[model samples]
Target: MLASRNRDTNSLLKSEKKSLLRFLALYTSLVILLITLLSIFYYQSQEKLMFSNQRAELSKYAYIQTKRLKVLHYFFPERTTYPRDPRFKSAIYDIEYKKIFSLLENENIHFNEEIYRAGNYIHFVKLLDTYYLGTKYLIIEVPEDMAWKKEAWKQIAIGSVLAFILFMVFGLILARLFLKPMRDSIVLLDRFIKDTTHELNTPLSAILTNIEMMDTDVMAEKNKKKLNRINIAAKTVSQLYKDLTYLTLKQEQKDHKEEIELQGLIRDRIEYFTALANTKQLYFELDTENVIIHADKQKITRVIDNLLSNAIKYNKRGGTISIKLRIGSLEVSDTGVGIDEEKIPFIFDRYMRFNQSEGGFGVGLSIVKKILDEYHIKIEVYSTINKGTKMVLTW
Candidate 1:
């Protein structure tokens, strides 16, 4: 059936979604890393500027203390009192970098550096021409000001947040742009398949109908064999056509739910594919019970048809196909080229084909999974390469 198909282009494919997430993660991480480096640089620059502004003021204080020390040196043994200031703490160190006398809370000082910071205090060293009270260095200590730090952190936090948001928005847009071509190509391919399958439907139906009506018993033996081959080919095409038709019309088809007897349905589908199985001389072993379930019959039929088709298509010549249907579960297994253990997880993905030697578009299992998922049925796969694969469906 040719139907007006509607699809949402905005939704991403599963592969595309994974790509987008990876890209965003790397992008966001890089953005955060860059912002962190810049924040560290900015904070250091601000701290250096603060230190520079206080350098001249601290130097002036040291000079005044030096002048008072000279006065005290002259008045030694008379007014022998050390100079003190409330604006800053002062420490005097000898030429050997040892403390002579210190008014500073933390007496530890570096003589090599002119100015540096220690715990909760900034120290400034001023070299003296004359040793006053046996002092060669006048060290000034002041409480480290942290007002600039608060401002720097505030700006950094705001900037980082803004930068992250902006980059994430750009990342999403770029990801969409990157996936656009793939999405477009898939859409075009889907449309082409739909159009080609639609044209083949009428001729395919006519061929099958005419073949059924032919009196093969009256034909020559060789002619009958050729007709049988043609019938097999036509049925294969018919099955493919059904699969494609179901996919193209899936959006428009409404569910016609009813009670379906599994035993009868399974027998009918097996009979339908008997000719194809005969081509390979494959034997079928059906162990079925009269299991009944409520669901859309057409959808359930597609599931069974796909399972049977795969078993036949991939089976070895003269191999055995075992089917077990019970009240709670069903298993379809074949002694064919079993799927690789690692590749089993992706078998249900759309257009997933493991064997290039086999002829198929690989939409069958995907369709099966879709229907089973809708009915809340669970399917398990037990497979071993070079042995066999068993598909177990449980409700």
Candidate 2:
């Protein structure tokens, strides 16, 4: 039971982790997308502000060059020095947008915009009131300033990283809060099942013990049949009780593996379920070898018992159950209502009921699967609807 509890707890923990991961993945992806957009917006706004702030300085340089050009234009070709400044490079274009003379590094200029960036320079176009020396357009060029961009990117990266960390912490808290109700419900149910299974042990043992001790001899034939019916019913409940107990509390019980003869174990389980099988007129066809394997006996018994129980429970009247055991494998085949191909995949899922016609909690195969997995055994299912089903376990 200790082991079973651990497996259950681990399974639940795995489920919780998966849910949290899915939530975080989606949440973080959206957060990243939003941050990217905001970063782009923030950078663009900063670029516009930088352009605005630098405009006055550039305009002052343009004024100085224009004044110089006017003075040189007044003196004709003799006094032509064409204004030059150490603070900025200048370009002149005629009314046709053709360059007259240029000191700017990049000759390609956008005349339509008053200010724009081209290559590694910022060009500011200024219209002169006087076309001094036939210069209608005055353009100023300066080396591109990317200091603001660098700082903006740095801040954006830091802010984005910090935002992600904070959101992740909040997301974790939300995930746990979302799962609290579900976890509490499961805990309540688990406690109830554990308590119920514990309460059932004493009564189930007494009933089985008294039935086994009963002597049907010298009784009326009708009375003997009634007693037999009682015994079968009691045993059915006993098996269910055992299954519940196995799932609920076996934690303290240490797993003890011993050399077990497969043939004898198979026979024993068959005999144990013989009364239940007889009720449906189902018979077993045993083709077992004297194969010996070392495994936990109780766990192995549960596996065999579940396979046989399912075969008998789902079989048609007088149906044949074939049990074949080999050196490293066991196969249980039944001429019963076979499972649907799609349903077969989920047959071992806990509390999964495919056929509502059958009366069961649907944990039998689930228990069988857990035990098989613990021993690293592989189970395969072959089924055809309305034909039959076969379960093979290969270690």
Best by TM-score: 1
What number of clashing residue pairs does each candidate have, in the order they appear? 0, 5
Model 1 over residues 336-380: C-alpha lDDT tens digits? 889988889889876677588988888899889989999999999
TM-scores, one per candidate: 0.82, 0.74
Q: What are the per-model C-alpha RMSD values against the true structure? A: 3.7, 4.7
Candidate number achieving the greatest lDDT relative to the actual structure:
1
Clashes of 1: 0
Q: Model 2: per-residue lDDT, tens digit, 175-228?
A: 899987866666566666667878888988898898888888878999999988
Task: For candidate 1, give the lDDT of residue 77.
Answer: 76
TM-score of 1: 0.82
Worst 10 residues of 1 by lDDT: 1-10
Error of 1 at 374 (Å): 1.9
